[model samples]
Target: MKHELKGLYAALLVPFDKDGQIIESGLREIVRNAIDVQQLDGLYVNGSSGENFLMNTEQKKTVFRIAKEEAQNEIKLIAQVGSLDLNEAIALGQYATELGYDALSAVTPFYYPFTFEEIRDYYFKIIEATQNDMIIYSIPGLTGVNITIDQFKTLFENEHIIGVKYTAPDFFLLERLRHAFPDKLIFSGFDEMLVQAAISGVDGAIGSTYNINGVRAQAIFKEARLGNVEKAYALQKESNDIIESVLNMGLYPTLKAALGEKGINTGLPKAPFHPFDESLRPQLKSLIQKYNL
Candidate 1:
């Protein structure tokens, strides 16, 4: 099935106060910046980057609702409603479908060392219940459940199982999957590897760093595909510099801090995730000015 839900998407970040309460205005500001300023193609709400795993069911739904409302069908939206709780996944999937998300993505069931069949069944259950297009979230590094090409073959047998958010660095498998399933959509999940993934034939990308560096991400993806290798790599190098620093200071908090610097009201991260270090403000500010983020 040819779908229109393909392009550069900010893995949608959420802001919260000290009590881990969602900051509604801050959240709206972030969404607005993503659409208006960053010019992202879409928002991937309630995904790992949004700290989805840390929030309860109600919080997740609130995010989905808020993003949909703020976006108002201006850009395509994909909801990452995956949870270890199967029932929650179904309910969230149904909810996002009702909210008119362009598509639904769910991480592979993790932390239990589930067999391939069980994981397959988990996806099947969500798709069957929600009756929406499903994109498999395959980040084996985090999930520890790797689906081989043949297994993907089996999952893709279902028309509702439309594609995958391929997060691993294994280009051989990516190439093979591209060759094997020309019809299925494949979105690269890593921001740092945007250039390579674009050249590897991914339909688009869903990334965390895209929240801040989406313009460059869009450039890298387009330049690489247009065979402007040198220009694409230049942007990738710049983006990687930002990614590396963000990883060093911290991913979520640091990104929020970067946005907060722009007066976007990106409050502190949820509890237990440390606030962005005040001492690093100088370095963060330097990065912001240097990159024009």
Candidate 2:
């Protein structure tokens, strides 16, 4: 709560070796790229972009440790400690808090058909255990747990439950949350919709694409805040062209491939997630060249 968590954040991408192990050196490089090159405000480590679900608990901790040690508080570092296992989430939350993460975000408890009360209790347990500010990572499109405004009201009652990384496409709910909980921090999650969320008054944003397109994202955020919607829209259009291509080629792999082109060892996406097609390299290069990414 004290960090005044606002501004553009790369959903911090982690690099891996062929054996699907954490490429620590590569990760340190990526963090440096985000802070130094991209000029992003923070790194959302171990979020969806980091392939959190695929990693073991130790791997997640390693990411938090490396990002903190590397960043050295130069920029904000948010550790996504959410997991299906409650104990794991708690342990990870504690670890991140100790390491000085700016904030802790947890995806809504998923997989099981958990009731609202169960979900609420899950958040409470983590906050109580860690004693750190919490951001609810609500991406119902993938998690299938849609939280209602009334439910949000219940969750926001706790002072430690600081805000949410709202990844859903519901602008209506986003607006309502903004109007209702004006004090709570709201981070827009979907990269392609950054302009709309910025216009709707989100504190800032977090996304995977920001790793490559962060400078533009900062422009869009600043322009929109300054009431330059036309400029923001134009930039958004150009950004969407890039985002569409990345999604079509493959999300994580294509992003890594883009970063790789810049001499950053971003490696490939983790197992179960396929790599970007070699055939697409020409096109991906065109994007990198076009965007100067």
Candidate 3:
């Protein structure tokens, strides 16, 4: 089936208990709130914001299953099934497809320094393994591997490869891609960069900060799309200010805490990912209230 995937999607936060277990109930509630109340365009499950790297295969599958079940087809779900292991990535892709995810995205492989040819092979392997359409995730900073314009063209040559979740700040390349592939979908990956991305013709954005600030992000995109630069910039500035606080307080913990403050109770981050400083909760709360998040 042709997918109607576009617009502002939140890279969901996975809530874990103190013992580092996925808090399924809490997560279900968070997803529910994100869809039912926040009214976001979609959910980007198991991405960088979702802490996918820290979890194992079983844990990742469990998250995929829970997110799908709770979403109940109410909103679009893009499963980030990418991993360092090619076989494992394929398995997750097939699993998510079977579970009814709307689309699948995979990060460029990291560590061990794979060549561009290897990266090309990796995406080819994934597209060949599953019938699901793919979105190439190009986050150069984290994965240390970037799909250059030529590489992206190679991947998009696959009829099933629909688009990309581009996280870098390279507007020149972004402009080039938009100009080259006007028909393909390109969702910006950085929440803070949504205005520029939207102006450059990005279809939408998938971001961690959107988990809390989706309403405003949606406004920014809507206004920008309609040529309301002043309004969009004002909203973008507000969103960026909040994101700045999130970066200072910590991304995952601040997200969890904000969710809890909203009464969703996402608990805390998994171990080795430290909790937000308790002292900063007041500051976070004030910021959230200030932004009406």
Candidate 4:
């Protein structure tokens, strides 16, 4: 059976010790909060917000294992197994499938300036590697490659291919994709842009900010689906305000700090990315309380 990849999914944050080691307990707590407390519809594991780029293969696999074991099929789990290495991508995809992940997503192969054909081949290879359905992760800002409408059509034609995590700000293209393939699932990648993406008919959202603000995000989506634009707009504005503050405070670090303050022990982000200082802890605490996160 095909997997149903829809609704508000948190692009989970990976916590690490001060020594830059994965804090398994902290990570499990965070995932539990996202699933049981926040009541998110699902999780998007190992995305940019999860610090996937900084992690090695073993670390990535550990995250997948822990998330799956802890999640225990309570909610949907979409494992992001994408990488620049095609072989690694396939390996991770298969591994995640075996771990009972609901679906697999891969960000467009990045950094090497691959041709369109090469990108297509990358997806083809991953889909061929496992029987699990795939979601194309299109974050042009990070990947430097945006799958065009034509490319999307080509991909959706594949039986195992399901949908995309559409991250770009271009609503025109998003509208076009929706018009062209009404049945395909399209997840909004930008938390700030969720209102517009939902307005444009995105099936759901996978956002970093949802970890803390999931209730509000869910309200926005529910209101929009109910045709209450005015209410949805108000909630979206609140979400954007929180996200703006997070961006200013350093996205990953601030998020971890906020989680830590909430007693999740989200640890520090894996390295090259610094943890928020003791001074900033008070500020993050204030922000969290202010937002009622």
Greater-TM-score candidate between 1 and 4: 1
Per-residue CA lDDT of model 3 for 8-115, tens digit only, reads 898988999888889999989889878876779899999888888999999999999999999978889999988888899999999999999998899988887899
lDDT per model vs. reference: 0.92, 0.93, 0.88, 0.89
Expressed as tens digits, the lDDT of each residue in 101-188 for candidate 2 is 9889999998889999999999999999999999999999998999999999999999999899999999999999999999999999
| Model 4 poorest 10 in a row by lDDT | 1-10
TM-score of each: 0.98, 0.98, 0.98, 0.97
Quote model 4's TM-score: 0.97
lDDT score for residue 263 of model 4: 84
Off by over 4 Å in 3: 1-3
Clashes per model (N, Cα, C within 3 A): 0, 0, 0, 0
Runs of candidate 1 exceeding 4 Å displacement: none
Between candidates 1 and 2, the one scoring higher on lDDT is 2
Q: Residue by residue across 1-293, what tens digits does model 4's lDDT show?
A: 34366799999999998787789998899899898777899999999999999999999999999999999979899999999888888999999999999889999988998998898888989989887898999989987897788988899999778899999999999999999998888899999988888888889999998888898999999888888999999999998989988898899988888877778989888879877767766777778888899
Please write out the lDDT profile of model 1 over residues 1-293, one tens digit for every residue: 33687788899999999999899999999999889888888888999999999999999999999999999989988889899999999999999999999889999999998999999999999999999999999999998888999999999999998999999999999999999999999999999899999999999999988888888888898899999999999999999999999999999999999999889998988878999999999999999999999
lDDT of 2 at 166: 96
RMSD of 3: 1.1
